[model samples]
Target: LGLALDKPLVAVETLAALAYNLYDTEGLVCPIMDARRRQVYTGIYRFAGHRLETVSGQEAIGMDELLGKLEGLDGPVTFLGDGVPIFRRQIEETFCQPFSFAPPHLGRQRAGAVGALGMQYYKEGKIQTAAEHRPEYLRVSQAERERAERERRAQEGQG
Candidate 1:
């Protein structure tokens, strides 16, 4: 609605905002959004005092791969976001390091966190014109994949 309201926009990375949900906690923070096909949109973060620092940038990756990356990091991890519920069992079964899931109240996406992060970004001169703002989708949509597959099959038929 920034465009409609003629207001400058601040783009808060979803994973970063989700990690901010645990700004008060110690150790590593992981925010995992279910990206389907057994993959998640995730990032590793830690709070250096009150400032959140990125241990790993957000990306679309399989749960196994993410777990593997976490194994190399020091200290316990606190996981949050939609992927927690879906991957909890697997994480418990496979992850070797100590970890805990965020309680239900703080597990999912929250607008408050996003707004707070957005405000921080604005203070840091990260604001952009509404026309310059764009949503970041970490991977191609299912529809796009399906369309590509269909084109490939059509080319095969022609050959």
Candidate 2:
């Protein structure tokens, strides 16, 4: 598989968004994956002149913050991904910009779409060996944090 990674935000929805953007659609392609704690992993993209242009890149941010960034953008934003339903109501209420959720067939993560994107990246010379591959855990797991806290408390004779 070929993919580039320079940031901790692993966009699970990128491939989905790319698939959805295959048509002659305009405005923003906002793909968001739930990150728990009211945050989501998201990115904004647009097909300007029929070429993909990243608006905000990928980010792990609260829904509110994400909305703030979209406040000034032009309308007709099409949002997709698993996180869409989680904040659907909030999205509807908060943004004055015209928006719509991608239908069931295109919104969720699909292996075919992801594989297609991987192939595209491979063609673009973004290949990397399995040895060079690494997982993108944007934040430490709660268990790890709790263990660290336990060790700290033990050292302080509080555990």
Candidate 3:
């Protein structure tokens, strides 16, 4: 751990790292992780002179909604991540712009990609102490949603 090593920690955003997997590719890079319930953890990105630029920030969003946002963007989009296999059919049926899936070998999350991006962040002075790091979940967990629903039902019954 960075704390034990006395080194600053460089946190790389998941979606950004996923998009980095396609660093050599051209056009837009869309990394979509299956978030279930017809939604995905995704973001739109593009490379500008070896620097990865975020066209859209990461978020947990519906597949349809994500597609809608991509619809307006120009150029062919390269899709990757676990969500591709799950939503391939829907994307084929609904998406009008040109697109292609990353080959299986490069489709999923890779540690190399994360490390590479982490290094980029580190060089850019984005390092932080381990205690200052935090995970960005993008949305509440399913268990939390279920607990809230149960609480609401109990309140309704008591009322």
Candidate 4:
């Protein structure tokens, strides 16, 4: 007899994970984190009655585009992660409303925060078992994307 699989797998991108965590714990609005090298992990959250839910599709985004979208929202925002220095200038230039950064100690990935948020989501029907979870990497690596584009162009030329 074949081995039986027991659980479903859910591949959540890093940003979505963070956003969900934040929303589930702190009830913050539109939390965003930079993943490095001009990429962002971002999403929006709002409080409804007793809980927070994400408005974003839980997707990773490029810096410029994410900034543009955030700019359009016109609200107070906070940023976290190691990418702060890399995109400081752009973020400052783009975000018109008040913005702030989490301290170095609080920034970056924290299992405690994740667990706290996860517990909230768990209570609200978002929990998944160990066998059900996977990491969500929003964007392809630069090399992979470039290669795919090259291949597409090559195929176009051939056609």
When sorted by TM-score, best at the front, the candidate numbers are 3, 1, 2, 4
Which pairs clash in the backbone of model 2?
Answer: none
Residue-level lDDT of model 3, residues 21-42, one tens digit each, is 9896789999999998899999
The TM-score, computed over Cα atoms with residue i paired to residue i, of candidate 4 is 0.65
TM-score leader: 3
TM for every model, in the order presented, reads 0.89, 0.74, 0.90, 0.65
TM-score computed on alpha carbons, candidate 3: 0.90
The Cα local distance difference test for each model comes to 0.91, 0.71, 0.91, 0.60
Worst 10 residues of 2 by lDDT: 3-12
RMSD of each: 1.7, 5.4, 1.8, 4.5
Clashing pairs in model 4? 12-136, 13-136
